[model samples]
Target: MTTVIEVQNLTKRYKDKRALDNVSLSLEEGAIYGLLGRNGAGKTTLMSILTAQNFASSGEVRVFGEQPYENARVLDRVCFVRESQKYPDDAYPRHAFKAASLFFRNWDQGLADQLIEQFQLPMKQTIKKLSRGQLSAVGVIIGLASRADLTFFDEPYLGLDAVARQIFYDRLLEDYAEHPRTIILSSHLIDEVANLIEKVIVIDNGRILLDDDTDAVRDRAVTVVGDAEKVDAWASGREVLHRESLGRVASITVLGGVSADERAEITASGLDLAPVSLQQLIVRLTQKAESATKVIAVKEGVR
Candidate 1:
């Protein structure tokens, strides 16, 4: 796998707020990545810096082995589909498509036409006149049809219904299989895109909290359900993220994976293992980090 993007000690600040802080990560070619977090997390800031749409206050960002800012060779290979993407007041859907075709060397007109029909887009209607969902469809169409080596879709499904979102996912997967490229999807819909992305990158409060393979990240935590006493004993000495007990039954979410031997031991001990959801794990992790920070601040105040 070739490295397509590299960020080292990247940080961005706006007055008193930090949008991205000491973040560094690498992305390889031909893989789907999920950029996930809460609304104010640094997902968008990170993406914007990588695509050269925004500047970082400190550190370095490289796409395709070169700085992306004002670099046409690098910019031409990248496509960023933002929910708030701007268009001329008089420009129609057709005009947007035409502009994209002119910019992207690998643009597929057939794919764009098919997506227009599937999304039921109005080519003649001005962009400002289209509904929110229709406008989202226009961006989705362009993102998929552009076929850029690196594409970023930042909440590109805004206002799209479940069925419409499903269409976007289906077409994206099909096309990706035929022509593999690096894709970074920044979405709040975690579970919906979980099965589609191979890796996950999470940010919280302007810092990177987690970055790992989707499956490996899932295995980082597990829940054990059974007798309270037995579950408590097994959970002892392990980092516990969450725990709940109802009568004699207890469900404990812990911060580690169970090995095969441990699995057999768990079954022998009359405990049941259940998988943790990505959304749940990430929420707990971020909450835990925030709690730790608060504790440190309180201790410093005492000093």
Candidate 2:
């Protein structure tokens, strides 16, 4: 598996704040990745820097083994689609698709046409006059049809309804199966794309919180439920992400996978294990980071 993008000790700061602080990660070719994080958690910042739309304040970044900044060879193979994608003042849907066709090396007119029809996009209307969902569809069509070797979609489903969003997903998966490439998707709709991504990279407060295979990430934590005392006993000394207690029963989510023996012990104790949703796990992790930051800030203020 060739490395498609690599960042080492990268930092991007704006005035007095750091958008990305010493972040590092490597993305392999032909893998779908979910770049998950809370709002203002550097997901967009990281993507912008990777695509050369923004520069890093320090450290290194390499795309396809070469720096991406002003590198047409590398840039042409990468396509970035975001909610705020802009076009010329008089541009129309056809204009955007035509331009994308000219830019992306592997541009497929047939795929673009298919998507436009499926999305029922109006070809003649000026882009500025199109509805929000239509605007999003333009980006989605370009992103999927461009077939760029590396693509980044930052909230590409912004104004799309459930059905349209599913269309995008279904088409993306279908095309990806026929033509495998690296794709980095950043979205607030975590559970929506949870099953689509092969790997997960979580960022929080300008730092890498978690990065691993999607399945392995799920196994990073487990939820146990039943008697409060038994649950506490089993979870004691472990990294607990969240816990809930009602009467004598408790539901505790703790870090680390349980072995078969551990499962047997849990069963013997009359405890039940439940699956944790990816969105829930990510929310808890980011919230935990936020709480810790507040605590540190409070301590510094006291000093």
Q: Over the stretch 1-303, how does candidate 1's per-residue lDDT look in tens digits? A: 899999999999999999998999999999999999999898888999999999999999989999999999999999999879999999999999999999999999999999999888888899999999999999999999999999999998999989889999999999999999999999889999999999999999889889899999999999999999999999999998888899999999999988999999999988999999998898888888888889999999999
Question: Number of backbone collisions per candidate, in order?
Answer: 0, 0
Model 2 Cα lDDT, one tens digit per residue, 232-279: 998999999999999999999988889999898889889999988898
lDDT of 2 at 254: 86
Task: Find the candidate with the highest lDDT and give its number.
Answer: 1
Candidate 2: give its CA RMSD in angstroms: 1.1
lDDT of 2 at 224: 96
| Candidate closest to the true structure, highest TM-score | 2
TM-score of each: 0.96, 0.97
On a 0 to 100 scale, what is the lDDT of residue 144 in model 2? Answer: 96
Candidate 1 contains a number of clashing pairs equal to 0
**What is the C-alpha local distance difference test score of candidate 1?**
0.93
